[model samples]
Target: MSKVKIAVIGCGSIAQHRHLPEYAMNEHVEIVAVCDIVEERVNKVASEYGVIAYTNYEELLADPEIEAVSVCTPNYLHAPISIAALEAGKHVLCEKPMATSSEEAMNMIEAAKKSNKKLMIGHNQRFVASHQKARKLIEDGELGKIYSFRTAFGHGGPEGWSVDGKESWFFKKNEAFIGAMGDLGVHKTDLLRFLLGEEFVEVGAFIETSAKENADVDDTAVCILRTESGIIGTLAASWSYVSKEDNSTVIYGEKAILRLEEDPVHNLILQYKNGEVVKCELGGIQTNEEGGQTTSHVISHFVQSIISDTIPPVPGEEGMKSLQVILAALESKETSKIITIN
Candidate 1:
């Protein structure tokens, strides 16, 4: 196929602001279909992108023209929809959190393996330039023996980002399956795993609804994670940052402390033990609280994987590993004890 025919299965805020726009810009991709339970939304998105709109995602998935499909629906539907798309012989680019539970995520991974299709998770945090640079720095051994790291992702709330505002599915336990932890914490877990190149073996967490008065889901959470390599760190996710968003990571090392997006002006900063500070401004981090998640390289990588017939950098199995950490965190919080990732 000269161009990959693609369909976006959710015409919500993320599909509108991120996936659709990115697909429009990708020359190798053709936006063939758009689907949503909301007919009005599906129509609007299809009209805007000049594609077919379907009220049911299954109808869109049945179309033989579409070579790939972006599963941008609610968290609970992620696994089922992505698995269906893969079984239909279409590559799937699923939105983050991957799924509500590790079992669902594993199902999607297995489906992709059985179908021999590309299954890329939309974990945009890993595609940011600053994060890429940080990963490179750590890989190059500039930070020496890494002692520990702290990563945080905070914003106002999903009320400000979701299409339905306060009534969105994000705040409902039945649909969302998780609160801020799944929304933002999963991203941090994925990023830490990517930067450190290790899997989290255990997790201890404190999850509570400290803010967002109208929401049933958690607004703030703090997780203590220990990786397979014996590295420990704090991963926090919050929707209570009324002042500003703090999507930053600081890695403590024997030689230096590397900070990513800690400074508003500088994208990265390396503070050495011997009184040396190196500041570098590469590009802006692609994560956004107000539904503006542009300037991300995730779509490009997904498309490249299709064109090259190569595995995506963040494939189904990779995303599943990240989701497992958050799942363990959830289990730990409920039990009031540390949970091990077996």
Candidate 2:
């Protein structure tokens, strides 16, 4: 097991831009195969990497040569494909919004445990340099008792990013389950939990499909969240930012405020109550725009975990917890009430 052989299950935007490239860069990983329903896309990627192409993920999983796989397919297929891969005795690195529901998420976790395989979720926001720094500062008491926060992730929509453009599964409710909330909101929920070291206890949201016409799924959502420690905040996800991407988080504390990815020059900024400001030029966060292909560190981390036989940084259980917040937000939108997380 010197070089863990791995395959990517979906040859879409995520696999192309993140998983495949990162895995290829990691010395401890060997790209064995790439799977996608689209024959041309899979073959092109396979040819580019000189690896095998698989139109059926089950066939890829049965190869036995592949020790791990990245599930980058549609939202609806995440659970089933991951569960199958785990059952087939392959470690899994699933993308964010792990599943459409808590039951499916728990099932995936159960499969990983039953098969004694690794199941890491791809919530790369926590791996951002600024985000990691913010977590450290909070942990070291730099931001004395956090009070409130506001985080947002907005872009020009997946039509520009997904390989299928406007016809991508992202705009389909059955395929994607939820829209902006599932695509972008879950990332914030996971990141908030990592930075604050707490779970969200309640959520109330207004999820709507106002921006993209002819789409049944939501394109914009605003959620109010309360942590277990009583810290309240707002989380927003939108696909209507026509001008530029806005991936920023502002955490207000008793003594200072921490802003992440909010500046063009500095990725992190700290403002103290004493009228002092500190700007940090930590590397840029990955964006959908050109030249925004910053390394996400997810694939590298996953490979390291598999090689070391250690639990992945963003394990299935952590993914499920993060996903619960989005599920609660969806419920809140439907009920028009604040939903409490169990």
Per-candidate TM-score against the hidden true structure: 0.97, 0.99
lDDT leader: 2
Pairs with backbone N, CA or C atoms under 3 Å apart (clashes), candidate 1: none
Residue range 70-137, candidate 1, lDDT tens digits: 88888989999999999999999999989987788889999999999999998988878888998999
List the lowest-lDDT window of 10 residues for candidate 2: 286-295
Candidate 2, residue 15: the lDDT equals 93
lDDT of 2 by residue, 1-342 (tens): 478999999999999998998998898889999999999999999999999999998899889889999999999999999999999999999998999999999999999999999999999999999999999999999999999999999998999999999999999999999999999999999999999999999999999988999689999999999999999999999999889899999999999999999999899999999999999998899887888856999988898898888999999999999999999999999999999999
Candidate lDDT values, in order? 0.90, 0.94
Report model 2's TM-score to 2 decimal places: 0.99
Candidate 2 lDDT at 150 equals: 99
Q: What lDDT does model 1 reach? A: 0.90
Candidate 1 weakest ten by summed lDDT: 286-295
